[model samples]
Target: MARDDRAVGVSSFEGQATSAGQASLAGEATGTASASGPHFAAGPPAETGEPLRHPPHGEGDERAGEVSAGGRGRPSRAPPSLSWLLFSRLVFPGIFLASGLAGLLTLREIVAPPLDMPRILSGLERGGSARAEALTQVHEAILDPRYRDLKADPELAESLIRVLETELRQPITGSPEFTVAYRAQLCRLVRELDTPRTVPVLLIAVECRIADTPQLDSPIRRAAAEGVVTALERHGPDCVRSVPGGVAALCRAAKDPVAPVRAAAAAALGHIGGDEVCDLLREMLHDDTDVVRYNAAIALAYAGRGTGLDTLHEFLRSENVRNLADTGSTESVIGDRTCKLLCRALFALDRLCDRSTEERLAVLHPAMEDLCLSRAPEEVRTLAMRVDLKIERFHR
Candidate 1:
């Protein structure tokens, strides 16, 4: 009886196993299996709550074998590598921050300009459109109170002047704007300051005639000429030679049809003492315009070149003869004044003449005797006596 029971139990177990295999095969065929365990089971389903779908042959299992090899397929839960995160978040912002700071600093420099003499000089040396722009900025800066104080510093002033001179010499070809701007600035500086320190610089600018560009408008040239005059007055003859082409320019102006120009030239020549200047004065003495002649005489006398004495003496003698014929007391008075100027000129010439003592005495003796014996003013007699004594002593 026990052997029988054992056989029945074995059969029952076999039957159960067969039934489970059949169920698994049916579930797989129907595509309704929960892929939770090795074998299919009829239960609540997997925690993922989905049925397993088998792929066809030669096709991959998308859920089980698919991979996001290059981050293409699925989203990831883990944070990216620290370096990558830093590159994404901090790198660009840091760069932008650095750039912003630099830009701000540059803007500040522009808004509140500094002297920056070296930089300004460098820009001026470049001498192009950029140089022109830099020069304009420098001029504006100079007018600013911040840089206005720099004028008090002689070294700074000299450096600035040198920069301007360099710009004038540079061969920059472009618009006339730079040229105009440069002349205006120089004129302003010269007019504003009367310091001896500025004298040499203004003289250099004048001598070069750097302001005399083809594009110079009328007002600009006038301003530049005025500056030249101021420099001439302040520094006198020594500064004239230091100016590059100053003497030649003034000599040319001596022939200008404009009376003021001729007058200014005469005055400039007077301030600039030289043998060449004396010749120019002598030429001016013969000018048709009395005003020109008068200025020339005054200038030549002031210069003490004494080259105009003979011309002045002839003019005075002619005037006297005309006065005698016309019986014009005014003409006579004018002649008397001319005689005085002539005597003074002769005395000056006697002193400067390179001739021997006997020759100088021979020339001066007649003029001295005439003035001493003439019914001239007391001042004239006194001046004649003084000149005679000088001549006598000089001869001895």
Candidate 2:
């Protein structure tokens, strides 16, 4: 998945090479083949069958009436022509060999080696599409075992975070969409690094607002918030709390005007246990956006707070959630997101139910039973049944 995304991200570079290189190669091959092809090489001149005659310099000039041994005046066959030999043995083979090598090299350029990390990090600091391209390579590198330890590179992670901060403040000089995408991708990289040092910067990114462009601001902030969630998951909330203003930053982001940013903040807060975080998440339960509310509920459950039980009950009844499980298409982005959110909710509920009183477990019974018996997708039904079993065990 990362590789496919990186391919798309760097498609501009590949598209340019494809047009120029492949077109030139096509023309070159056509010109060479046509020049040597039978159509271009004229056939021998037609035989008139007349004796060859020339002005006789003298009466006995033997060259005056020259003819072939058959007396048909045909030119005697001679050794193969030099041009033919070169075209047949050298040029023809050379054309194919050159074409093969050219094609191989073109493919090599399109699928170039992963740029070295230092070079990639340098390009990222340079900004613009170079930064976008560099981020793509870094994403691919993270998946590569050779660069898997990238998460541990404290210096590199800090440098990238600084670049991210500087780039976010700069005016949009290129396609705004491209700018937003790279900024989001940069946040994703910080998330991948799983370094606690980036917690402070990630917090700053979540609240950093781009002027007059909610379209741009929302995605970047959402990505930054997700980065915070990833850090908490890896190193725990203590790492974030240690950073001055980190928890406060998240609290502010939980109320971001953008629903996705709010949703991401709820997810991050779920990993932390505290009255403040729970209060914030509980407040978020009333958010207008369905995803925001759902995320807030799931987060509260993660903190072992049952304040989100009603929200989870509501989530189980949502038409969108029910349909998401039944959809046959695997590529639907909404479907994937819904599935993940549903899975998280079920897992959170299952854990939460384990600690609930018998009466509390009874509150969840109807939703769990209905989900298990319904035509929800197999995975959803399976998880719902697990929740039922957990509830049943308490009764037993």
Candidate 3:
């Protein structure tokens, strides 16, 4: 019986090895065995034969037991646990399936594309119902902060602005929240997209001063003004328009007690200058504050027309007299800025003047020489050289 038991154990070990090898071959072909095969190293046999009893004990029973145990050792096999099988077959496959499904969903969204109002609006009327609906979708998207990140997408930004314009046209009581949210979204879009569409909306927002409530005025108005300035700076003359009340507000801002408001207005006027801008700048040239006058001179240089040259020349001569009177010891930076402004104004005037080449050269030569040779700031020298070169080229 002992010999039979030993033979059976050896046969069981051989059978197990053969089964493992076959399973490995199948796994290599199907790819499933790679993860599961390692676990079978300690797997139990497919069948457990009847238990074998030990030989009867005698005087040398201890020695005999040791010999028998050593000669016919059974292979160690760990019992298969349901938990391990479930993890191997069910849990891992579930994770892979979930990841694949997620990828598919993402691909679907990308291929189908989202609604893009800016592109749609390119072919639709600004005030039409189609545009309004598109804008509404954008407005809804932006009201959530998550859409803020989406602003990086140009199409999304365009849609948001279209919606914002529609909201602006509605009555104030219609949905103040929507109006305010739309303006906020417009502000973000202008800063993010900095496109032409944002320009008109920014101007309208500034002109409307939508934040009538005291609590809302300071932050919202400041942001709107900044947006308008940014739009103009980025897009230049094309984005500028001469709204009836727009110039008036800017003109008032030029004289505002607050220096920043005044500066912003001066910059805006320079950006959108016309006959009206020239007039406003001329009046401000005589302002009580030298700072205001200095800015006015700069604006005049930027917005100047044919007569603008003569007016700036007079200011330059007046500033020269003022500088001489002070003996150049004044701490007021405005005086220095005024001198620079005068130099620029002279340059701008030289560009627009229709005098003979000789006459233009004679008029501009002194200022050009002073700008180059004197300790004038680099900007002044640069502008002077640019003007001089332009004049030379024009004559050529």
Best by TM-score: 2
**TM-score for all predictions?**
0.34, 0.65, 0.39
lDDT of 1 at 131: 65
The CA-based lDDT of model 3 is what?
0.58
Expressed as tens digits, the lDDT of each residue in 1-396 for candidate 3 is: 999999999999999999888878766665554555432332223344545555666746666566667986444457879998998899999999999999998776556445564555553345456655654565565454544545456665565566656656665555666656655655554555546666656556554445456344333344555566666767775565644455566666566554544555665676677887778777876667654565565565566444334444455446552452345432567656565555546555554543333343435555556555545555655666776666667666
Give the higher-lDDT candidate: 2 or 3: 2
Residue clash pairs of candidate 3 = 135-163
What tens digits encode model 2's per-residue C-alpha lDDT throughout 149-194? 6778776787788888897788766687777776787788787885
Best by lDDT: 2
Which pairs of residues collide in model 1?
none
- Please, what is the whole-model Cα lDDT of each candidate in the order they appear? 0.59, 0.79, 0.58
What's the lDDT of the predicted structure labeled candidate 2? 0.79
Shift of residue 332 alpha carbon in model 1, Å: 37
Ranking 1 against 2 by lDDT, winner: 2
The TM-score, computed over Cα atoms with residue i paired to residue i, of candidate 2 is: 0.65
Q: After superposition, how far is residue 46 of candidate 2 from its true place, in Å?
A: 68
Off by over 4 Å in 3: 1-153, 159-192, 204-230, 233-238, 242-252, 255-257, 306-367, 374-380, 389-396
